[model samples]
Target: MKHLKTPESLLFYMMLIREFELKIAEMFAYGKLAGTMFHLSVGQEATSVGTIAALEEGDFISSHHRGHGHMIALGADIKLMMAEMFGKRTGYCKGKGGSMHIADIELGNLGANGIVGAGIPIATGAAYAVRYRGGKQVVLCPFGDGAVNEGVFHESLNFAALHKLPIVYVIENNQYAMSTSVTKSTSITDLYKRACAYGISGEFVDGMDVEAVLETTKKAVERARRGEGPTLIESRTYRYYGHSRSDPAPYRTKEEEEEWKQRDPIKQYQRKLIERGIITENDVKKMGEEIQKILDEAVKFADESPYPEPSEIFEDIYA
Candidate 1:
């Protein structure tokens, strides 16, 4: 097993993402947020934190609509993120990108795309840029299972394979594409196998297990750094919320949701850490309190921050 950082740090990051997302949900419900739509990756914290833990500072990432966890895991400021959600000028995009389009270019985040499967080709192009400049950076492209059905998915994968681009295509297969299940949407259940069609390696991972995700992504990252080209990783995860803020998620059953909850990544990792004597229950509680305090301050900052002026409406727009 590769030394994938201390278990304590991994657990902390997972908790941070979970708490941040949970707060976002609460804020949205109270009309504290300005956006009309929001997507939460509540049950998918492990996949985001674990995969990102294996990356270096210079590495790049492209995110999907449910991408807050991805940005938080990548060291984004919670206050700024919350400010953006509230349409404040302190946000990463000067309050223009909102929740779905936040990007910190200085941090190597290429920004999250609202369109399905749009980030795939963007990541592929970034990888090509890395290769051309002989840079050691590798790009991680994450999207939903629904994105696999998009034409850009095939085109991007084929082009990356042909040119040996330094990227990893991480498929966050959260079972449902909005209300439609993967079974109803695609004939190929094994999403990773689609990588073979483009002559690249692929692997499936239990998205709830942070350790598994970290180990698997580490190998893929190492391969890309070695100039071995892209690898596809299909992480089977679940979303605890609807596709957006207004979605009720009536398509799934109570039992199905409960079953996935039992495998809650944060709880599972907490158990493992306690079992190994790495941390006590008190430590876990303390960590939770600390994260909660951070988020509380973030919300306060966002609430107090000024919104973008009406005169600035056309400033950031690109013709």
Candidate 2:
């Protein structure tokens, strides 16, 4: 068991993810955010922040549609991220890709995909590139439990391991693939065992615990950087919000939602920080205030930024 070493920096990161997520929620309510949102990382912040922390600056990550947390955790500019959602030219994609398609290649964030499981092959290919160049960079490919059902998931894992590529396939198993729960999707409850078919190591971690996720991911990242091939990690977590903004999550029970909220990774981590003397209530409050100010400025920037001009429509496209 790798014990987590609590540090002040890590506590700050946990707080940032939480504050950013909450700000996004507020933006949605204020009608400031446009486009469809796939919210639900409310209880899964640790899995994102911790895993990203284990990666180096050159390492890459491919995100799911619900990718805001991953991008923020990887040090994406909140202003541009918010601008992209607002369809302003200041977006990472220059206003082309909205919430589902944000990408910052400079930050090693390959991109997020609207199509389910599409990024698996992309991440595998990126890993192959790193291997071909003899670089130590690893790729963290994160998707939901729903992605595992895709044919590309199995094929990509097989190819990644076969070639000894440097990649960590992290399945954010938040219990449900949209409305379908894990119980209704797969017969084998243990998502980790699925890696056996690919002939690689598979580990399960507490997705709600930042320390646990960070420690486990650090090991996997080290192994991959050493050219030990891929590792599949199933992070058992829960999403407090609905699958999308439109979803009421009627299939789930209020009791179930409440139970998961009690296990919220952000709040849990805050308490841990306080308990460890790494941070205090005032520290958390100050962090929250700073994040809100940052986000508020981002919102102002996005609102004031210009939209795409008429001639810009076919610029980035190839016919």
Best by lDDT: 1
What lDDT does each candidate get?
A: 0.91, 0.85
Model 2: pairs clashing at backbone N, Cα or C within 3 Å: none
Q: Report the lDDT of model 2 for residue 55.
A: 89
* lDDT of model number 2: 0.85
CA lDDT, candidate 2, residue 283: 85
RMSD of each: 1.9, 2.7
Per-residue error for 46 in candidate 1, Å, reads 0.8
Question: Which 10-residue span in candidate 2 carries the lowest summed lDDT?
Answer: 1-10
| 56: Cα error in model 2, Å | 0.6
TM-score per prediction, in order, is 0.97, 0.95
Backbone clashes for every candidate come to: 0, 0
* Top of the candidates by TM-score: 1
